[model samples]
Target: MKGSDPKPQSYEQLPLQFQLYDCSAGQSDCSQCRAVPEEYGCVWCSGTCVYNQSCTSVPADTCPPPQITQVSERCSVLSSSQMTCPTPAVTPEVKVKGVWFQLDNVRVHYETIKGKSFTYYPNPEFFPLNREAPDAPYRFKPGGVIAVEGQHLTRAISRQEVKARLGDRECEVKTLDNTHLYCEPPEIQPLSVDDRSELPCLKVFMGNLEVELGRVQYDSDSLSVVPLAAQISLAAGAAVIILSVLVVILMYRRKSKQALRDYKKVLLQLETLEINVGDQCRKEFTVASFPPF
Candidate 1:
């Protein structure tokens, strides 16, 4: 009976058999003919087998699957004991697409894949933008100084770098000595739908300072450089204001001189008229007194 119980067979009792065949047509009793089929069939086998007639093929090697790592969406809030809202996990496949920052210190980081992106906002609502809480116990002004620490900061970052990276983001930079630098984006026309829908932008900050490297903007249309124009307009406006002020001062002085001259001439004419009246009165009194003789 061929194992009627159908129990699992041991290695020694297995039905598997290995045999070797002579590869040479003329050789009948060669050592190659006696090679084991199971041993020499594949390169992984332990024994030799026929070169062509018997199994003597090599198998390919395969590697294990790749591993995936998870990135945290929520960054730690400085000095706050409470943890901020949970953020979505960032996958290796995700790429930074667009970035925007609020007037407050809170930063919003965005990432995208296949034209879709995710936003992660940090806790601690920034000031100036949070006007609703006027009497709130924790009122922070927009220009207050603050210090930040991050993984990649070598030195303090300026407000210009932050604006460049975050695109119209507003923040206040403070030195250790409490020197404040207010950075606000210039007011410009609104972006079109195409500009808003363009590829995602990323703004990375190390502490309070912004990272200058790896910053990129992918606008479909040409970049509208406005700094030069803004500067020129500012300069022109200042010059006009200064000139206007000078002209006003000069006009006021001229008017004051003309009024003073008119006052002096009126005073002199009044004195001359009083003297003439006194002389006429004296001459008429003398004539009246002599008329009786």
Candidate 2:
């Protein structure tokens, strides 16, 4: 990195000076050169005192913290209490009963085969995952950010290393963390019945490794979006049904208890009347005994 004919004279051209090192200006200090923070895309060459950076090998052993170089939409991450939600970090996880599964996070009811597992190796590299949720199908907004999650990923891999595609449309993907990659999908074309082309593939590639996440199914028909009012009405209907069932059960129990109480009261009255009749018979029998005496 050191040569006499170095870079521009912009206070950056200086040679490494030692005890006997003397420049044309008889200077032996390199402090002024080391303070420049690479402001002009070039910093002080490590071993040399010149600012026209000639150090080609960057020390990979030490790395600075990562920073977001683009704008991002916000996402909530499940974290311990008091931790804040990360901005634009979106890798959804699935919760089943008391256990958590590292599967596609689609908000819908589904049943999976217990203890099922499968493996995939990236073929020529790219696997983009698409999960279908039940209820009313939500249409994808073109240019909206979509999150793809993977296991055992690391920050060492840069966003440039991964490539994502929806069908043939290239999705600009950005890595947010070890587990999530965000992509902006292009406008999608719905499939038609007459379309004989193979279903469009959603894949992410890392060099030559490719994982087949799934296939996209487009249709000429569109799903009807359920409005907020209809959803509220459905919830109210369910509540009404549950309340009616509880009321009927309470009424049945009350009727049974009333009948039991009435039967017990009648039995007590009949016992009292039988005792009175026995007393009257005893009085008549006593009179006959007196005449014999």
Candidate 3:
């Protein structure tokens, strides 16, 4: 038991048939025998242990997100076009059956055409009428009801018509191609409201007669006959013109003042120089008479 290597311990001495146990369930295991559970191992086991032998459950596969598709078309007729009438040279007539009030600066004429109908002719010459015609025929047909309408008919005659009738006074005519026809008319300023109010409702001026056709009441406070934007623009233009005039006047005054000041300074300098030269000549003459050194 000492230096003779003490008899080597036999398997029986080391408990060759000792109880084997599963360590996973805290069961005791033999130190020398092999009775391991499915994947349970002992502390002395050298190989890799398969503790979790059951396969893991996987999630179901999902589909990818949907993609957007674009569609193209050509020459498709518009729904509005299909619903509306085709563009024709002769537009349909618009009937304005109501009481008509014709007003000018001097007089207001009311004509009630009971049960009358007029064919709205589109005259290209009457550009601002919003009607397509210049020589629109307003036939006062029978069977039309009328009501009271008021206001000055300022747009009875167009500037072009006035120019044509008057043979172009200080006015230039612009053609369809933007070409200008220049003719100097006798200078006639627009009549003021007061002056115009004194004139007859229907008057002839310079061989051109103006008649009041109809009047539409316009509220200066609300329903803007002339848009606020346009009025503001006109006001801005006027203010700019006034400011320009004031600047020119101020510049002219400043230049004039500067010129006057410069002229005075030059005159003063000339007078001083002349006095100084005279005094020096007198001193030289006095010195020459006193001594010839």
Best model per TM-score: 2
lDDT for each residue of candidate 1 in 79-168, tens digit (9 for 90 to 100): 555433333434333443454333268654434223445443332122222234423222222223222223222233333333322243
* Candidate 2 runs further than 4 Å off: 1-200, 204-208, 211-215, 218-225, 288-293
Which portions of model 3 miss their true places by more than 4 Å?
A: 1-226, 290-293
**Model 1 poorest ten-residue lDDT run:** 121-130
- Encode model 3's per-residue lDDT on 41-102: one tens digit a residue: 33322222113332133211232243343222222346853331111123222223322332
TM-score of each: 0.27, 0.29, 0.25
Residue 91 lDDT in candidate 1: 38
For each of the candidates, give the backbone clash count. Answer: 6, 15, 21
- Once model 3 is optimally superposed onto the true structure by TM-score, how far is the C-alpha of residue 142 displaced, in angstroms? 26
The 0-to-1 C-alpha lDDT of every candidate, in the order given, reads 0.42, 0.52, 0.36
- How accurate locally is residue 14 in candidate 2, as Cα lDDT from 0 to 100? 78
Better model by TM-score: candidate 1 vs candidate 3: 1
Candidates in descending TM-score order: 2, 1, 3
